[model samples]
Target chain A: MEPVTTIHGRAYPFGQKNVDTDVIIPSHWLKTITREGLGRGAFETLRADPDNLFDSVEFAGSPILVAGDNFGCGSSREHAAWALLDLGIRAVIAPSFSDIFSGNAFKNGILTVVLPQAAIDRLIEVAQSQPIHIDLDSQTVTTPFQDRFAFDIDPFRKTCLLNGLDEVGLTLAQGDAIGAFEDTVRVERPFLAVGVGS
Target chain B: MATTHPRTLYQKIWDAHVVERRDDGTCLIYIDRHLVHEVTSPQAFEALRLAGRTVRRPDLTLAVPDHNLPTTARRDAAGQRIAIADRESAQQLAALERNAPAFGIRYIGDADAEQGIVHVVGPEQGFSLPGATIVCGDSHTACHGGLGALAFGIGTSEVEHVLATQTLLLKQSKSMEVRVEGDLGPGVTAKDLVLHITGVLGAAGGTGYVIEYTGAAIRALSIEGRLTVSNMAIEHGARAGLIAPDDTTVAYVKGRPYAPKGADWDKAVAWWRSLATDPGAVYDKVVVIDAAAIVPSVTWGTSPEDVVPITGVVPAPDSFADASKRDAAAKSLAYMGLTAGQAMASVEIQNVFIGSCTNSRIEDLRAAAAVLKGRHKAPHVKWAIVVPGSGLVKAMAEAEGLDRVFVDAGFEWREPGCSACLGMNPDKVPAGERCASTSNRNFVGRQGPGARTHLVSPAMAAAAAVAGHLTDVRDMI
Candidate 1:
């Protein structure tokens, strides 16, 4: 995981709503064991159209994405996040997001920004022409058009992202307490620990 | 005198799972059971390997290959391994088989008697227990919550986290109580209840809340019926749904293979009984639905909320006051190739799939069998398939002759493993074809690209197969 504070770059301005994980990366693409090189399959159905926004030259290598409400609405597949990451998307701006998808994106170092529909509309227009700036420290998204929008994120998640602390790292930080709890369980409820490992 | 707050079932489970609470409000909660399937476990294993971390509690984890196995046996040369038609599906399943043993996790794979959809096998094998914290990589993990567990879905990253630590960092969600009062009329089923609830609450209605289903209607349902209701909770944007355990749940759990025996069993039951929500517990939101008002319903648009009774007609997009909903309805209608104001019963369907985590249990099979017996599928119905929830379910249904009833009625009685649910396996509703499905989601292309899915109950789906179109199961009954 990488620490993310500010992501300033061109963004894909596709503002489609209710964009489910199935559409983000279809089930067929999930058959692979490895998560690498999924960008090719990311938005494959949409990219089939020559005029699709994802394949447009203007948004090529964009580090940000602006989407509509209820983004990533279906499925708990982290492949959606992996696909976006592989496609060079570092942040996503939407009015709202599916909680599971948002959690996955946060763990994978992708920033999900929630703003009002008006702010999103402005960002979509600005993203089509120029770059958008996202400053996590300031909790604001800005464009050269002087448009600025503030957002809110859980303080815990913001700290984890800023510190590059993945779940493994965070859990390991509380190693002593977890070990003690395991010891107590071994004594108090030995049955819970049994019947494991076939 | 100190006063203790009355806690809902969700709050009790959440409070019990908390290992440590941080000042920032995120808590590291213990996970008692972690269910894994072929589709989502591969990357998580890879992540574990990269981090050089072994599973911390392999005993608490159960691995099954469900999403990829062929429902119908396929043979190649030696016939040692069931032939998987898709290369990626085969590779993914093989990866899980290889990985599970190395991690010391219990792996049920490839026609094994215990093998089935992860959600089905969890409860079937007694791995899902009351007062436990369960997590799976599949959204239908909520199915286990019917047994009074706090079960929900996680992603690959969280899967890896659970593998390494048997815990997850999460913020507690608000709680909602969906109270279904009164008894369901004859011909009404749990599938109908969930569909009706989804219609009342829309796709995003339960967002940021864990739902607890209560009231006379819920308590009257059989254990299997309760599972079906909880299984579709994710369809309405809830991460999890639960029904507190009672005598019905106790009866279902006792004597199961993994269930505790002797003194341990007594202790387990006592603890499970205590897990019920305390009386007078308050919820963030309360929704009361009259079970008598619910009829056999089906989805018309892509969203599950875009539904009506089988006797109803497709709604015009313009009927919606919200601009976005109207736009979505229009797009869904176009994609589904449905006309506004057309009778739902008149809409013909070529494929009928009566299996999924949501409605493939023994009770669901029996319900469809009752409708299919002494009848035949309509000539125009291209494929009517019945897949059981698990291999054990298949064996049990066969023992009851439910499979024969379906087969005699012109429906294909296939093996288990989420067949035709998401259409990732060989069973798929072809593009441009419409299907009467008992699965939960009605999203566009959920069955297949350009495939239209009409969500219904198992009996309703059976009725459709016989009528060659969407028909009211009440009429057939």
Candidate 2:
């Protein structure tokens, strides 16, 4: 994972609501064992149009996406996040996001910023012709026209994103605590540890 | 006097599983059971191999290959392996086979009688116990919550985290109780009730809450029925959904291959009996539904919340007061090839699918079989198939001659493995075709690209097959 501090780029001003994982990277694309080259399949359905926002020259390498409410509404497939990352998307600005998608984005170093619908409308308008800026440390999104919007994120997630921390490594460092918990479970919740190490 | 902290079922489970709590309110909660499937797990296993990290607790993990496995005959007439036609899917399944043994995790093979959808296999083997914390990479993991477990779906990154450490860093979710009072009418099933609930809550209504289903209507449902309701919690944006264990749940778990025996069983039962929410425990939110008002419901659009009663007509976008909803409705109508004000029953469908983690259990099969027993599919309904949830479910249905019933009714009795649900396998509805399906989602291309799906219960699906349209199951009953 790479550290994410600030991102400034033209945004894909797609404001479609209820954009699900099935729409992100269809189930067929999920057959790969590796996570690379998923950019070709990201929003495959929507990208079918020759003039789709994703393929248009203006937003071709956009690092940000402005979408509508309830983004990433279904499927726990991290492929959605992977697909976005592959498409050079570093941050997503939506009115709201599905819980699972939000977690998956954070894990993959993709920032998911939630703003009011009014703010989202303005960003979409501004993104049509200008670049949008997102700062993790400040928890704000800004446009060159002096439009600014503050957002809220879990403090722990913000730290992890800013530092590009490997969550597995961090959790492994606490192996002693985990082992102790298992030791307690052996006696207190014996059924949980049944048929272990056999 | 020491005051007893009246905790909800979720709070009790969370507290019991806490390995450690951080100042930021994120708790490193111990995971009791981890279920792994083929599609979402390959990358996680690769990450583990790269990190040189072995599974911390292989005993607590179970892996099965289902998503990419073909539902067609796994063995030829000579009982030899039938190779999967898709190269990529075959490779993904092969990876799981290799990684499971390499990590010392239990793997259910393609030909094994126990092999099934991860969510279905969990409760059947009693691996998903009452008060257990279960996590899987698939969104439908909430299905295990039917047995009183605290279960939710995680992504591949979290999957890798769980493999390296038998815990998850998490924040506690606010609890919501969905209480359904009154009796469900005839032909109205748990699937119908849940579809109605999804419509009531909208897709993101339960976004940050764990919903606990309660009340007399819920209590009356069978274990399989309860699982059907809990399975769709994700469709409504909830991470998990739960039902308190009762005699029905106990009976379902007793004597399973992985369930405790003798003294352990008694102790387990005693603990399970105490796992229900304490009376007077308050919740962050509560939703009440009149069960009697629920009818045989089906989704009219792509979103799960785009549902209507079987007797209703197609809703127009203008009927939605909200601008966004209205826009979505119009898009859905165009994509689904449905016209506003058209009667739901008159909306013809060419295909029918009776399977998924949501409704492929034995009871679901029985319900659909009962409806198909003495009838054949309508001539216009070109294709119909019934895929059981698991090999055990398939064998059980066959033992009761349900396969004959379906075959006689012109429906194919296929082997089980999430066939046609997400269409990752060979089974798929043709593009531009409408299907009456028992799967959870009606999302675009979920069955196949341009395949429009209308979600319904098994009985309703069977009824649709016979009528060649989305007809009311109550009429057939």
TM-score values for chain B across all models = 0.98, 0.99
Error in Å for residue B205 of model 2:
1.3
Candidate DockQ scores, in order: 0.36, 0.38
Listed per model in order, the count of residue pairs whose N, CA or C atoms clash below 3 Å is 1, 0
Model 2's alpha-carbon lDDT is 0.91
Candidate 2, position B80, lDDT:
100
| Tens-digit lDDT string for candidate 1 (B362-421) | 999999999999999999899999989898999999999998899999999887888887
Docking class of 1: acceptable
List per-candidate RMSD values in Å.
5.7, 6.3
Off by over 4 Å in 1: A1-28, A39-164, A183-198, B1-3, B74-79
Position B254, candidate 1: lDDT: 85
* Model 2 C-alpha lDDT per residue in residues B1-477, reported as the tens digit of each score: 233878799988888899989987999999999999988888898878866788999999999888878888999999999999889889999999999999999999999999998888988888888889999998899998888999999878888999889899999999999999999999999999999999999999999999999999999999999999999999998999999999999999998888888887888888888888998899999999999999999999999999999999999999999999999999999999999999999999999999999999999999999899899999999989998999999999999999999999999988778888986889999999999999999999999989999999999999999988899988888
State, as a TM-score between 0 and 1, how close model 2 is to the true structure.
Answer: 0.83
**Best candidate per DockQ, number?**
2
TM-score of each: 0.83, 0.83
